[model samples]
Target: MFLITDEQLDALLYDLATLYGYDFSGYSRPMLHRRFNRMFRLKEFSGFEDFRRAISNKPELLNWLVAEITVPVTEMFRDPEFFKVLREMVLPAVANAPLIRIWHAGCSTGEEAYSMAILLKELDLLHKSILYATDINPEVLKKAAAGVYPQNILEKYAENYYAAGGNQSFNDYYTSSYDLVKLNEQLKKKIVFSTHNLVTDASFNHFNLIICRNVIIYFNQQLQNRVLNLFDASLEQQGYLALGTKETLQFTSVNQQYQKPFPKEKIWQKI
Candidate 1:
């Protein structure tokens, strides 16, 4: 196995950013190193230089690298309590609106977006809601738009749904076709999946609520603050912000601009 030196890693990140605009410079080095090393081994590269030459020869490899690096490990109703709070408390806060726009920032494979759709449908808000599910990976966005999942994962997701206060049979939301399950057409229609990089992209629309969970941990504090500020800007006054359980705004620049309504679940409201 070849060891990747710090200088080589820095050059790789710089080259990727400069040549393709896929910047990983703001990402945590240790995390990047781990992911880079994993890909290096998987690709059977002799060293960093070999990998760099390969990327130079086939530029599209950068897209695969981006997908691997930012690939999200997420599930439907990931933290059941988070979705529980969103249903029992958060949705009601915005339910009265004629048109409610919610942004699922860093949405991966459409699980959380579908979870939200289920919640909105149960609350009779689905028709009035327009959900935007964004991720940096176009491939993931394509899967999200399809709203399909492996059948093996549906059992776990069903449990999450029940725990998150699902009021109806979870099976009603999807139909199995061989090895995959497709989410309901109605629910799928409520969500629009698009590719948006939290690091480099500007906010395309204002939202009543923004849910960004478990995605920013790979970023350094500086990038986290930048993203938090972006969310703050993208949200309407007094709108809601939902983050992963481990994420916090207490130390970020936007900390004072939002208040925790469901602190345990990391749901904050803009002030």
Candidate 2:
């Protein structure tokens, strides 16, 4: 029950970033404090200093922290109307292309990636689509790459699927066994899940569409701007960018660079 002072938290974060090169400085202070506090209690660390020492000495603990902090709380088609707009408007525009590269930023446990794959398959573009599902947490990326989800969640996802204009039965995309639903191999093959640090790493590839939903909300304005710039650079000319319904680039420096394709859904087209 040791209280973490502001100075202690700052020193701990700075030391970790310097030693590990994973920058969490841009994350919101309150959010970071809460996450760290939870981890502290769970691990039984006596104080912030103790947690810092463990993180420095045991690099694996840092990975655990990263997973705990960066993992998105998401579900398939969490925003159904967004996917509907994507299918009706964005898909048609990109469908004619010979190939498409999509980056699903902050894709946790692969729900959004699978959702995208299912949508592309319905549109007969799955074969030509390469989805890069990126998250900073390697643990989550491993799970996402495996494409297995809890069986209990499938019913809800199925409802989301139908609501988002699914063309076929959602059951067709997964096989249920025991408590798990293994995503179809066909859908898994189209997606490449990888670990990516939006705060510290440079953009690696240009994508036709970048769906970074709800990830930036925990980031400070400076970090959000940095990530947005990375996304801008990573996107091709006239590419599409989709954000969470509650997020927007309207007041940001990059606001003028993208036009609103569907303001309600928060889909923007690169200008």
Candidate lDDT values, in order = 0.88, 0.87
Least accurate stretch of 10 residues (summed lDDT) in model 1?
Answer: 55-64
Candidate 2 regions with alpha-carbon error over 4 angstroms? 58-60
Worst 10 residues of 2 by lDDT: 1-10
Model 1 lDDT tens row, 1-271: 6767899899888888888777888998998888888888889986677899887677567767887788767888888988888999999999887789999998978889999999999999999999999998887788889888899998899899999999799999999999999999999998988888899999888899999988887889999999999999999887999887788888889999988876577889999
Error of 1 at 183 (Å): 0.9
Q: What is the TM-score of each predicted model, taking all chains together?
A: 0.95, 0.93
Error of 1 at 53 (Å): 1.9
TM-score of decoy 1: 0.95
